[model samples]
Target: MNPFDPTVHLPDELLERIRERAPIHDRDNTFPEQDLEELRAAGYLSILVPAARGGAGLSLAQAAILQQRLASAAPATALAINMHLVWTGVAKVFSDRGVPGLEFVQDGAVAGEVFAFGISEAGNDLVLFGSDTEAAPTADGGYAFTGTKIFTSLAPVWTKLGLHGLDTTSPDAPKLVFAFVERTDAITTSDDWDTLGMRATQSRTTRLNGAVADAAHVVRRIDAGPGPDPIVFGIFSVFEILLASVYTGIARRAIDLAVHAASSRRSKKTGAAYSQDPDIRWRIADMGLAYDALPPQIAALARDVDERVDNGARWFVLLSGVKHRAITMAKHVVDQAMLVGGGGSYFSSNELSRLYRDVLAGAFHPSDPESAHATAASAWLGPLES
Candidate 1:
């Protein structure tokens, strides 16, 4: 296949259109359905589904680059779509490793089916290691999931919900079930999604009451706590890397905005552009230095996953660290951009102001500051004496 060129799939014109709609969605606190429609029409929804499976057949690294570009234009749109891409990315992991279960996911994406991530639960810090939700096996090989999933992106339009729960009734007596269920009557999506940033995501709460995943859709049943399961690795690796790409893109946009502000805004004292000011130059340079450090890290790690390079147990640390770094760096760059943007950026209508708000949501995503620190600490210092 030809080297994945992002501009081919996501043209400058398409991105400009999406960028134009971002503030409208943010202001109205509405999902960017038009953005989704354009992306879907452009075959972006199936970018990783493998060329043979009728997709763009891009690697995870390529996907990361594309997502960063997409996020630069409309962060909330990119973020909302990231959930759908996560499942597909996981399916790619399965296919690449000679696994057979997730072909349906690839096919589903090609068929224009939208998949929503439904893993997050309130107060469940165990994350991928455990689940507070219940998963009961049915007479058939399927399982029924009952729980409430918080922060379910693509809540309004997902045709299938991919989620997990704990099954205590089987002989194993405590297995984590990862499965997918169609959006039937058993599932309810709450209308509560108001937030300070990324408002266009419309990532509302999801309630699963006896939602059944047929045998085919039931992907994995593994021992609860973190283990050497491929599913676990696939989810974590793709999720963290893709997430880092989004925030890194946010930082990239901030840098561009800062450059524009510095060039366009002039100081009354010298009647010269802010770009000529020593302090502003230093700030922009600092932002560039910080931002330049992340994409390579993301690309290398993503390439490792793509090429099946075993990073061993350090994989989690690396993934979480990159995500943590990306968000924190993005926040810093946006802060700098706000300063360079002058008092006008403080207004709600300013793009820099929107970016400031959007960047805040990065801290709340997985591998949060606390969890990222905990993972890194455990990796380097070993588990604390308990």
Candidate 2:
């Protein structure tokens, strides 16, 4: 089995194509069709699939590195790609169980079909907790999922969807199942993703009224587990790191632009270059310092994950801390980049603007800064008796 290598990842050519299409994608707030096509062609969409199942057998750490590299070129493309990779990881978790609806997920991955998470719902303040969507068990032993899922990121191009919910009628239903649904079976609404940043993600609304899902499509229930699976935990940790990495990439790009602009642009009064100014140099230095601190912190977290998996320890607190630290660092880096880049960074033409917006998205994700901090603090306070 070939191990996934971020350094040797061959998606550079594909990423270059995404970069070419980014401006148009952003301008129109449309999905990066070209980018998705290239990713599918380059086998990037299935990078998380197991080796036996024809995937690249990449580790979470490697995936994080690759995401950062890709994000440097295009954050929206990286976001869409990340969603696909996450869904693929989810599919791998169910692969061994011979889950019904999930076979199509594997099939879609092999066939270059994209996947997205349909978690966020309309009028739901809390994405995870307040899902209005109901999964009712039918007489036929299948489930009928009827609800609207808003912010369905990457839905326009995704071939499959990962649906998360509980039995609405039975609020205390002991199990929570993450269902893998075929996109064709669900009704999709267009252009619902109107945001200040990451507009190119094409995260629209999906109406899944009466969508059918069977035992095969419905994977394992949450209560079926005794301990957290290392692979699943590792993958979740990777997502946190990847979120930071994408912002780190954006920050780096902003620094590069700032450097180039400072070196070339001269001060009118002093006849000195901006790069030669003490203030500009200090700001740039601050950006560099922030960027430098991220990799080591995130790498440390990834190493901790690897160590825990190796030692067979369940450390949910560690994962929470990693997510909290990485996201905080990402915010700091992006903020510093904006400060160093100055007013010109406000323009859409400036990559810094996009990076700024992309970094903001991290602050709002499910494992957001506030929740992560609370989780870590609670863990430090001591475990509560169940």
Candidate 3:
């Protein structure tokens, strides 16, 4: 087998096409179905599955880099695909650890089945540790999940929904059930995805009404509330790293645009290019300084996950910290780019304007500002007294 080359999987021509369509999707506030189809044809959806599983067999680190590149072209497209990659990445984690289960996920991906992440709930800050959804056991030893999932990206096209619900009627009673269910009649995806940015994602609200995950699809049954479950680690690690990659891509795009703007626009006062202006130079340099630190961080941490380097309790701290930093840094870079682009960027038609709105969605993702700070504080100082 050859070393994985991202360009082979995601060529520049494909990225340019996706970039060309990004503005249209954003303007129309629609899902990038064409982008999805193109990526699917490129075998991008199966990038993380093992080679024997008929995938690209790329490492999580490589996937992170590809995602960054994709995001630079179409941020919402990259973000929407992130959910699918998360499941495959988790499957890889299970495979590498010799853990049983999740082979179905790998098989499903190879078979061209789309998986949508269905864990987030409104106002559920416990994230991955607990669930408001109820998981009632069936006679067949499967489970029926009943709850609403928010921010369900790929709602329109996902064939499988990977979700979690709390089981209260079992012998152990109160086990968190992680399972996958087909998108059947029981699932309802609301058409309420209008937003300031990332409109192309179409990440709408999802309602699961007695949605069933058969015994074969039931992957995990563990005690709720913060245990050392590989599923938890898998989701958190892949999710945060990929998310950071997306925002880092946004920052990279913003810097590139700023560079273009600085070079093309000439200052009337000095009759020199804005790139020659000291203020613009400093601003661009500041953006570079901030942006330079992120990709390497994403690469290093993703490599750690791929190599299984044990950071133990610090894993969450590090994961959440990188995500937090990526979003903040990307936002700063985009803001600076907007200023550098001047009044023209304020128009809705400008790409920088779109990026400005798209970057805001990063803050709403998991490990939010408050949660990141809380995690770091607990890691540094002991948990606060009751």
Query: Which one is best on lDDT?
Result: 3
lDDT digits (tens) for residues 118-142 of candidate 2: 7777655544443467777767655
Give per-model TM-scores.
Answer: 0.99, 0.84, 0.99
TM-score pick, better of 2 and 3? 3
Alpha-carbon lDDT of model 2: 0.68
Clashing pairs in 1: none
lDDT of 2 at 38: 68
**Candidate 1, 88-114: lDDT as tens digits:** 999999999998899999999999999
Question: Each candidate's lDDT (Cα)?
Answer: 0.95, 0.68, 0.96
Q: Is candidate 2 or candidate 3 better by lDDT?
A: 3
Model 1 ranges with Cα > 4 A deviation: 1-3
- Estimate candidate 3's alpha-carbon lDDT, on a 0 to 1 scale: 0.96
- lDDT by residue for model 3 over 244-308, one digit each (tens)? 99999999999999999999999989999999999999999999999999999999999999998
lDDT sort, best first:
3, 1, 2
